[model samples]
Target chain A: TQLLEQSPQFLSIQEGENLTVYCNSSSVFSSLQWYRQEPGEGPVLLVTVVTGGEVKKLKRLTFQFGDARKDSSLHITAAQTGDTGLYLCAVPASGGSYIPTFGRGTSLIVHP
Target chain B: DAGITQSPRHKVTETGTPVTLRCHQTENHRYMYWYRQDPGHGLRLIHYSYGVKDTDKGEVSDGYSVSRSKTEDFLLTLESATSSQTSVYFCAISARDRVRNEQFFGPGTRLTVL
Candidate 1:
């Protein structure tokens, strides 16, 4: 099983503060995906990055894949209370299974 | 919100009792998966189905079983419940063969075994 490690297991910040979280792995990935999960709800797909050194933006959030395709980062600008949730990174399982292996995730809370 | 629905959103059962959870989708997706979410463990795949009557075990499939008789319905059954089985269960669907593409998840089912 391929394992993805997420940094900063927990984060609590004030509104309007900027923050960044990371996901890293030793295995090379063909593609990576990010998902945000709110309380009492299932996770929602935020974005998918396929190319190495690729960067994608979603309004206040920015996602970047490493040049080696073994790491990724998520930066949230001017965080708001609505941004409070668990952020997870996933990659396809090794051996071409296409099954996803998820990171433990980073739990963020933005206080108003 | 991909038309995925999990039945009995919340359930509480005693040990040794049999429990089953249902997942229904309207998207007609060809792939379905069952996962359990627990703290420190992330989301662990329990089972998945590629087509009707075709299924495979995931990372944690010991005490759980799944069956898909039709395109839209998938069922997960626990022959005997245990405290260790208590967790939030989620059902996901994908339009393509590879889960690396995109997946739509159900609201989730919180199961408690005491």
Candidate 2:
């Protein structure tokens, strides 16, 4: 089974502060996705990076895939109270199985 | 949104009782999956169905079973509930094949076993 580990399991920051969450894996992935889940709800997809060294931006959120396809990172700039949630990283298993393996997740709280 | 729904939003059951959680979809997606989320374990796959009546066990499928009789509904059954089985369960569906499709998840069901 492929394992993805997320660092800084919990984070709390004041509004307007910046934060970064990391997801690392030993196995290579064909595609990687980031999701944000609010309390009492399932996760919602934030971004999907399919190529190595790929970077995608959505408003204040920036997502980056590793050059080796074995890691990814999410950065939030000028965080707001609405940015508080659980962030998760997922990758589809290699070798023709599209089953996804998920990281434990980083819970971020942006306080105003 | 993937147009997924899970029934029995919250359930409290005794050990050794049978429990079933229903996941219904309106998108007619071809792939469906069942997963359990725990505090330290994150989300673990219990089972997944690639098509109607075609299902496969996931990493943690010991006492759990699943059935997909129609394209819109996937059922997950716990033959004998245990305290350890208590957790939040989520159901997800993908429109394209598992190889290249994004999965849409349901709101989730919270189960407490005593």
Say which candidate scores most in TM-score: 1
Candidate 2 residue spans exceeding 4 A from truth: B96-99
Give per-residue CA lDDT, model 2, range A1-112, as digits (tens). Answer: 8889998899999999999999998988788889998999998988889889999999999999999999999999999999999999988756667577889999999988
Q: Tell me the spans in candidate 1 whose CA falls farther than 4 Å from its real position.
A: B97-99
* Poorest 10 consecutive residues by lDDT, candidate 1 chain A: A91-100
Return the clash pairs for model 2, or none: none
Best by DockQ: 1
Cα displacement (angstroms), candidate 1, residue A24, comes to 0.5
Q: Give the TM-score of candidate 1.
A: 0.96
- Give the alpha-carbon lDDT of every model: 0.92, 0.91
Tens-place lDDT per residue, model 2, B1-114, is 668999999999999999999999999888899999988888899999989999999999999999999999999999999999999999998764444467789999999999
Best by lDDT, which number? 1
